[model samples]
Structure formats: C-alpha cells, structure tokens
Target chain A: EDQVTQSPEALRLQEGESSSLNCSYTVSGLRGLFWYRQDPGKGPEFLFTLYSAGEEKEKERLKATITKKESFLHITAPKPEDSATYLCAVQKNTGFQKLVFGTGTRLLVSP
Target chain B: EAGVVQSPRYKIIEKKQPVAFWCNPISGHNTLYWYRQNLGQGPELLIRYENEEAVDDSQLPKDRFSAERLKGVDSTLKIQPAELGDSAVYLCASSFGRGSYEQYFGPGTRLTVT
Candidate 1:
C-alpha cells in the first residue's frame, strides 16, 4: 500500500531558528513528491514538487530535498510568519492523478 | 486570475440531515477534485473529475455521499443523512489539465455535525 508519514507531529521553534521536517513515503512507483504550507482556516499553498531522488528546490528561507525513500523540508532562519502546518504528498506513476498525503507537521515559530 | 472558490465557509447541521457544498474551480481548468480533511490530518481525495466526467471516486462513500460537476466548470458535493464522523473541511482544487503537477485550492467549507 502507498503511504506517507510525516514526523515531528508538532514543533516549536524560536524566531530565526533553523530546523527540518521529515516525510517518508512508500509507493509502488514514485512519480512526484510535493510540499505545501497550510495556514489556519485556509487551504494548502503549493511549495515545491520534487520528481526524482537527489532533486532539491528552494524558495527564500525554505529548501526541499528528496531522496529515494524520503523528503526533507529545511527551514533556514524561520520567522513567525513561517509558522503553519507543512503537508507532504506523493503521486504514483500509475497514470492516476490522486495524491496520497501525510497527516502533516505542525510548525510554530515563536517571536 | 481568481483562485478556486467555495461557498458557505462554515455550516452546522444535525445528524441525518442533508447538506451540500459547492465549488468553482479556476477558469479554464479542466481537472477538478474534492477532498475531505479531518482535524490534525491531511486532505484525502474523495473524487476527481476530468471535464464533466468523474474518473475517480473510489474513496467516496456512495451510500451517503454524491457529487456532480456539470458543464465541467463548477461542482457540488452532497451528503444525505449526515453522520457525526462527517464533520470535516471539504476542500476543492483544480489543475490546468490532466497530469498537471500543480493544483490550486479553495478556502474550503467547514462542516460541523451535532
């Protein structure tokens, strides 16, 4: 069965602190791995899409790196505004567009 | 352009009652999706539509849940005889076309069953 697991269910970081969230996935055939940031009462916002192992993408203070079995979202000098639930999802290579998602990691960057 | 739109940001209903949620995807998007998100969990796909046809609905509980996307521009999801476990946020998303990697989402409708 295809599954996605996100670790560190909740994290509290002080402003300017750096940390990483983990997403481990098991799929029949890896097609794409995606990261999203969701604020309270809002739908998730797209962050990055890594299609292959050893691929990495960055935006401002956020960087995402992927491996064969997992992905890491690294936050560098995160600010309070960066606080939100980070979601991880994976798409299989079976020609279906449905995404299997993890429970997500709740991040709180305190000022 | 405008992002996906959904109506009735929040709703409270009693069990066994019928309720419906609506969604308007981004203009020109041919693929639309509906997902249910529980507290502390990520959104789960309930159905996927390609134009006016439903291509994936295996996860939807057909016994009580039904969805429709006529004209392929907007969609509606209805639940008959709601149950307590049905309380969750219903999110709608759309992509430019099939196989598109990026999807834009709406604010979602939060349903609370009492």
Candidate 2:
C-alpha cells in the first residue's frame, strides 16, 4: 500500500521566520511528489511537483526538495499571507496514477 | 485560461435528502476529478473521468453517489439520501490529460448535512 506521513501537524512562525515541513512516503514506485497549499474553505492550489530524488522546485518564498524516501517544503521569510495548510501527496508508477495524500501540516505565520 | 468552476459554493441539507454539485473543467482539459475532503485531512479521490468516460471510481460509494460528465466538458456529482457523515468539502480538479501530473482545482463547495 502507498502511504504518506507529514510531521508537525501544526506550526506557528513569526514573520520572516524560516521553517521546513516534512513529508515521508512509502510506495511501490514513486512516480511523483506533489505539494499543495489550501486556505480555509478553499480548494487546494498547486504548488510544485518533484519527480527525482535530487529534484527541487521553488516559487517565490517557497522551495520544495525531494529525497529517496521523503520530501521537504522549505518556507523562507514567510509572511502572514503565506499561512495555510500545506499538503503532501505521492503518486505511484502504476494503476490509475491516483494520489495518496497525507493529513497535511497547518502553518500559521503572524506578522 | 479560466480555472475549474464549481457551483453552489455552500449547501446545507437535512439528512436523507438529495443534493448535487456541478463542475466545469478548464477548457481543453480532458481529465476531470472529484474529491472529498474532511476537516483536518487531505482530499480523497471520489471519481476520475477522462473526457466523457469515467476511468476510475473505486472509492466512490455507489450505494448513494453517482457522477456524470457530458460532452467531456462539464460534470455533475449527485448523492441521494445524504448522511451526516457526508458533510465535507467537495473539490473539482482538471488536468490536460490523464498523464498530466499537475491538476488545477476550483473553489470547492462546502456541504453541510444536518
């Protein structure tokens, strides 16, 4: 079975503070790793997709990196607007290519 | 390009009642998906459609839920005799194709079953 686990269920950070959210996964063959940001009462917004172990992608103040068994979403100098629930999902190489998602990490950045 | 569109941003209905939600995927997108998200949890796939055909619906509760996509553009998900446990956010997403990894989502519809 494919499973994903995210650590630090909730995090609080001061403006300009930097922190990292973790996503660990176990799958038969990892096709891709995805990161999404969801605000209260809104659908998740696509952030980045990491395919290989050494791959990394960035957008504005957010950066995502992947490893053989895990992935990290690093928030640099975050702001209040960046506060949202960050979700991690993994896709397998076979089947319908459905995504297996973790519970997610809730982030609160105070200005 | 316009993103996915969903209707009835919020809905509240009594248990055992019927309800429906609609979605219009991005133009030219051939793959559409419906997902349910419980509070404090990630979204779970309910059904997936490639154009007008449903390619995956393994997790859907066929006993109460049904979905349809017509002309490969717009889709609807309906639930008959709703249950209190069905209260959650229904999200619609679309991608260029089944092989596309990135899915753009719409503002979900919040359903409340009392």
Candidate 3:
C-alpha cells in the first residue's frame, strides 16, 4: 500500500531557530513529492514539488530536498509567521495518479 | 488573477441537517478538486474533475455525499444528514491542467457539526 509518514508530530522553535521536517514515503513509483504549508482555518499553500531523487527547491527560508525513499523540508531560521502545519504529499504512479498525504508536522515558531 | 474561491467560510449546524458548499476555481483552470481535511491531518481528496467529468471519486462517500461541476466552471459539494464525524474543513482547489501543474487552493469552508 502507498503511504506517507512524517516525523516529529509537533515541534516548537524559538524565533530564528532552524529545523528540519522529514517525510518518508512507501510506494511503487513515486511520481512527485510535494510540500505545503497550511494555517489554522485556511487551505494549504503549495510550497514546492520534487520530482526526482537528489532534487532540491528553495524559497526564501524554506528548502525542500528529495531522496529515493523520502524527503526533507529544512527551515533556515524560522519566524513566528512561519509557524504552521507543514504537509507532505506524494503523487504515486498508480493508474489514478492521486495524492497520498501524511498527517503532517505542526511547527510553532515563537518570537 | 484571483485564486480558487469557496463560500460559507464557516458553518455550524445540528447533526443530521443538510448543508451545501460552493467553489469557484481560477479562471481557465481545466481541473478542479474537492478535499476533506480533518483536524491535525492533511487534506484528503474526495473527488477530482477533469473538465466536467469526475475522473476519480472512489473515496467519496456517495451514499450521502454528492458533488457537481456544471459547465466545467464552478462546483458544489453537498452532504445530507451529516454525522458528527463529518465536521471538517472542505477545501477546493484547481490547477491549470489535471495535475499537470501546481494547484491553487481556496480559503476553504469550515463545517461544524453540533
């Protein structure tokens, strides 16, 4: 069965502290791995999509890197506003090509 | 351009009551999706539409849940006799193509089952 699992269910960080979130996935063929940030009561905002192993994408303070079996989102100096739930989703090569998501990692960046 | 838009930002209704939510995707987007998000979890796809045809809805609890996207533009999701466990945020999103590009999400409708 295809599934995604994220580690450290919750994390608390002081302002300007850096951290990393991990997302491990098991699937037949991983088409793409996606990262998203969601605030309370709002929809998730797309962050980045990693299509192949050894690929990486960065935006400001957030960086996403992908490996053959998993991915990691590294936050370089987080801020209070960066506090939110970070979700990991995988697009499998199954016929449907739908996304399978993990429960996510709740990140609280306090000032 | 504006992003995907969903109405009824929040709703509170008694159990077993019927309710409906609407969504308007970004203009010219060819694919639309509806997802259910429970607290502390990521969104789960309920249905996905390519144009006006529902390509995938196997996860949708069709017995009481119904959705439609007429004219291939706007869409609506309805649930009758909602259960307590049904309290969740309903999110709508659209992409320029069917998963061929990044998706744009709406604010979502937070439904409360009291």
lDDT scores for all predictions? 0.96, 0.95, 0.92
Q: What share of the true interface contacts does candidate 1 keep?
A: 0.84
Tell me how each candidate scores on DockQ against the true complex: 0.89, 0.89, 0.80
lDDT of 3 by residue, A1-111 (tens): 889999889999999989999999998988899999988878999999999999999999999999999999999999999999999999976677887889999999999
Fraction of true interface contacts that also occur in model 3 = 0.84
User: Where does candidate 3 chain A have its weakest 10-residue lDDT segment?
Assistant: A92-101
What TM-score against the true chain A does chain A of each candidate get?
A: 0.98, 0.99, 0.98
Docking class of 2: high
Give per-residue CA lDDT, model 2, range B84-109, as digits (tens).
99999999999996789998899999
1 or 3, greater by lDDT: 1
First chain TM-score, candidate 3: 0.98
| 1 against 2, candidate with superior lDDT | 1
Q: What is the DockQ of candidate 1?
A: 0.89
* Candidate 2 lDDT, A1-111, residue by residue in tens: 889999899999999999999999999998999999999978999999999999999999999999999999999999999999999999888999988899999999999
- Provide interface RMSD per model, one decimal: 0.6, 0.6, 1.2
